[model samples]
Target: MPPEKKDLRNAGRGARARTPQFVKNFRGVKNWKEASTWLEWRQIEDIECITPDQAGVARGKMMPSKKFTSNTSLALPSAVFMTTITGSYPEDGNGFSYPEDDGDLKLVPDLSTLSVVPWESDPTAQVICDLVHQDGRSVEFTPRNLLRRVVAAYARRGLKPVVAPEIEFYLVRKNPDPDYPLTPPVGRSGRPIGGGQGYSIAGVNEFDELIDDIYHFSEAQGLEIDTLIHEEGAGQLEINLRHGDPVELADQVFLFKRTIREAALKHDTYATFMAKPIQGQPGSAMHIHQSIIDKKTGRNIFSTEDGSESEAFLHFIGGMQKHMPNALVMMAPYVNSYRRLTQAASAPVNTKWGYDNRTTAFRIPRSDPAARRVENRIPSSDANPYLALAGSLACGLIGLINEEKPDAPVGTTANEDRIDLPRGLLEAVERFEGDTTLRDTLGGGFVSTYAAIKKAEFETFMEVISPWEREFLLLNV
Candidate 1:
């Protein structure tokens, strides 16, 4: 017979006894402090402190486990956040140079983000943090901080932008081999998904347990997911979060990804947000819907009093078309992301705009004038939400500032339009490097640092020898 399971309710009893009085009095939670086994408990309390570097990468370290029961405060060297802005160190490499190598800076947790770890085996709680200089200034390289700056710019003009993200990802059977093709996970129905099942209710029902857990845990972590649907690819699903503040939505997207992956693992499957995890199938995307409203009037600026198209809406589209090519690095980010932007993949390859059309990079969704908005179909699900939102809002703001005029919207087949967008990661990086408008708007330091990181990642990717080379080139050449 199998051994009986231990009661988890009393697991932390012993550790609670050894915890310091001040530590037990932490205001973050009541249960955590009152629990037993403070020193020997299997439960863990961790702070999910993070800062976004120049490549739109979030990098940070967890606070020591002991710190949780010893003190309420947590801190880390500020230089930890700056090391990745440039290619000074490879993703896996340790050696890197930073201006504050002597550890003059510190990361301070923003208590507002404190939440219990809904996914950890051990009870855990975390708080997102921001990096501060030794002299107490916010770091410019921080992606979240950068986005706040753009949002403030819009606020100065009496406009507030709201965003909702539809994130698509795949559920695949876990395969240890790197070269093997991935197949769908065996669902609760005891069968693997056969092929594309776009919007099929049965496809969603197949993975009901995992999906149900995702909803439960998302709510526990305060992520307001509005809808879940089966997407175009086999075993693919999309989670749509309700539209809200840009920063809050970005945070939800970031955490939602983690929640989905964890739930998948617990249910004996793997979930991936890779832009094109499967070849010859519809690629995953993070379609962002955005609209601006007057802060005072609380009305959408994209529509007129008579529900007609407004000039602000046209200028927003114009700005997106002008800046999208340069902002490709942030939207797509990875080399694999470019693969997802191919023709016929339902992914936009050009910067054309249309009404209720999926072929264009930007589309005006059919909605009430009060709900008027632009949908950015370019960004992959693999992108960093903070940077993507920042790039997009900044571009549209430029258009609103200059009142730029957009060309006539395409009636159909935007793919046939010859409008150019960066064709690959290298081209996108070059475009980003040369563009001064995005640099000045987003920040010069961030642009240069991001360029260095992408350059390094691209060079490393080039060093890999894929199975295709050995299969075709070895015999023919």
Candidate 2:
């Protein structure tokens, strides 16, 4: 049975009380209750939080900090989360903003997300919050809430989605300078990795201490992580999470990233979830394996009594193909995400479906009929898991509703007959904006807000002077 909330809370409290005095002093907190508490929520491309202490209280409610407003510039709020001004603002700076005032929103904690900060120096606890208006309506811009809505839609149809994410990341030596290339950490062998070491047991053992800490902390926080394997890249590794409800899996993925990074920092290395952190190497991807089951019968909807592919399975893939172009912005949220989608990068660049073919965007892995699923290979490690799962499942739901038919499965190589997907962030955002079906399905407000945020980020990226530009253009052009 699952642990009760009261039991978990008591365990967290016990752990907090045992925190060392020196640790508390370093963290600048007197006790657990007095420690800084943050209400975290997912913004466009990253996570942002507000401390309740800074924002004044109101009738037993915690107000949002001043930086929560939509008009606030990213620079004013430490310039970390890549936040941007809402599109409602005019170019000439003479117009009304959507979130007219700051501190008008409230963060209602989801009690299930309550967890003690296992890696923090001080005894700190955090709860993921849902952004809502003062009157108690959910904010459309909230990614978690959006995912909840999608999950509810599936529940309404008596269908439940099971998702397992395989997240690939890199451990690199700490480099203070931004211009230098990142190198793999010296492992237990006292030597840095040089080239691909795919699925090597020795590779995983090299970082045994760090991986053990990650597993221990994840268990303490109730994250159900599964197998860990060395990936193809020099310093890349993949961690698999056991399949479960989409929302629950999303939450675990979100927290697990933080856990891994913290563990790496403690070990004097840096863990990066960037899709393609190294050039001329295999890129990291968050491949999502998804399957649907009938909530009533608990039967796999993708397979029939005789273990053959069901019509619903075909339609689900068809739906995914139709909506994948529009969903690219959420799946590959960053500008660097495109670098991972290049041809033969081991990342999919089209919506081709196949059986055990890694080259296809959607691959049907070898599994029992009862575990039939489709694996989406487009999403990068940098994607917000909540948004990625929500978009993917929503598209599948659309297909099931309309009984759409998928194209014939490609052979061993999908390189010949596949529709090319969007290759840039701009193209992706434009497709997302233009898709009316997605707008209605994922909400118009979310579509507009997401597009605005990505556009702002892209504009910022365009202004940067790169080494390539300087080296080539200084004398040649």
Candidate 3:
């Protein structure tokens, strides 16, 4: 028989003990050559060469360590980039024509992202890849590559973007059937987790074992976790990552999601990143804190020499205020994602900017000159971190170029303000497609392809009837 689970109720906490600095294997591998040497040194048996799709899901080939080293060329169908979340493809539309032959795109590994698979029984390693055409042109719509393009844009102006993401998710009871709604998992207290325990020490301790595994897995892969806290919803928790390069942080988030899910399963539960997983509960958000640095001066461009707000700072906010409405589709991608944007939820309904106010989409958090930044509260947890960061940074880049002034910052809570954002996926798609500036900035091909994919997903969702409709519309409407 299995051993009894340890009692975690009221376990000593103020914050759980920090993840010990576990030395990571293959942490210094910078190329396939180095990867091969490390594999041999550590006796790694297999390697997973993967890439993040438009939905931020890992897609690619796994092979024996020898095979991975012997075969330098790896390829996957170009269609992989165009496929929707439901595994369906959209026919040619919006200037994006699906190639008749479904040509292959080569997978070029980004060696910096290489790390060990801590959960695997056999010794294994995984590295992220970038897709490129047969002619070597980068796939514009690929999530990671898209972020690279945006980062390159910043580099061209002697600027670098630093971003920190606060990712929130929920741990739910293991449910095999999709026909039923998800419920919170029972904690070490042997009772179903309850809501309104935000920031409670005991609240986070309730799932101590699972949280411990999360930290262990993250440390094994060299992923940094700045803080962890219980969120407002039952069984919901948030992880804040250390601030760093946007691309690097996006890669961490991509891998971290997989790690979280794996750790949850180890504890006989499921971890979900859905924006609005449960009804009447607060939705999860991936609030991104962002700032720009002048590469030459090695100083934050958002602040002046005297520590006052700079023109670049206001312009960045101005850009977001102007363009973020169109980019909302990328941040909140699914039909269910819109459920989290309601006024009753702890989410912003409008694009109002304010100082340290949580009710607005863009908030200027209080920090020192070096740390001064804007927190974009619009993106949901389910968003593709790569696409979300790219969208937010792209808007700020345009704002810098236009040098436009933002409206007066809202002093009071902006919760009562009008809902300026799109109400649903279809509406958001329409706004995204109509914005030529954003389209041109974030590759036209990418914008059109993304819009098409989202439209297809929305269409698929419409085919299903929710229980709410069955309950009310079946008899009354």
Q: How does model 3 score by TM-score?
A: 0.94
Candidate 2, 1-477: lDDT as tens digits: 243212322356676576444332311223323322221111112123321110011112222332332323221121111144221221212111244334455665454565555786544444455566667787665677788888888899999999999999999999999788788889989999766789999999999999999988887666777899999898899999999988778877877888899999999999999888878878899999999999999999999999999999999999998888888988998788998988765898888899999989999999999999999998899888888888899889888988988889987777445448887989998998888877788887677766766776688778888889999999998
How displaced is residue 434 in candidate 3, in Å?
0.7
- Tell me how far the alpha carbon of residue 60 in candidate 2 is from the true structure, in angstroms, after superposition: 17
In model 1, what is the error at residue 325, expressed in angstroms?
0.7
Misplaced by over 4 Å in model 2 are 1-97, 416-419
Evaluated at residue 37, the lDDT of candidate 1 is 35
Ranking by lDDT: 3, 1, 2
The top-ranked prediction according to lDDT is 3
Best by TM-score: 3
Per-residue accuracy of model 3 over 1-477 as CA lDDT, tens digit each? 221222222224531242122213435466667666566545678889999999999999998988888866899998999999999998787787888998999998887777889999998988888999999999898999999999999999999999999999999999999889999989999999999989988999999999999999999888999999999999999999999999999999999999999999999999999999988789999999999999999999999999999999999999999999999998999998999999745799888899998888999998999899999999999999999999999999999999968999998878776898999999999999999899988999899899989989988998998898999999897
Compared with the true structure, what per-residue lDDT tens digits does model 1 show for residues 1-477?
221233333437774464456333222333434322332233454545665554444466665455654544444654444443334443422222344344644666555455556887665666566767767887665678778888998999999999999999999999878879888788778887867688899999999889999988877666677888999898999999899999878877877877898999998789999899987778899999999999999999999999999999999999998988898898888888988987655898888899999999999999999999999999999888988898899889988987888888987888755647888888998898787887878887667656656767777778789889999999999
The count of residue-pair clashes in candidate 3 stands at 0
The 0-to-1 C-alpha lDDT of every candidate, in the order given, reads: 0.77, 0.74, 0.90
For each candidate, give its TM-score against the true structure: 0.86, 0.82, 0.94
Candidate 2, pairs of clashing residues? none
By TM-score, the better pick of 2 and 3 is 3
* lDDT: the better of candidates 1 and 3: 3
Candidate structures ordered by TM-score, highest first = 3, 1, 2
Candidate 1's C-alpha runs over 4 A off are: 1-46, 51-59, 63-105
Root-mean-square deviation (CA) per prediction: 6.6, 8.7, 7.5
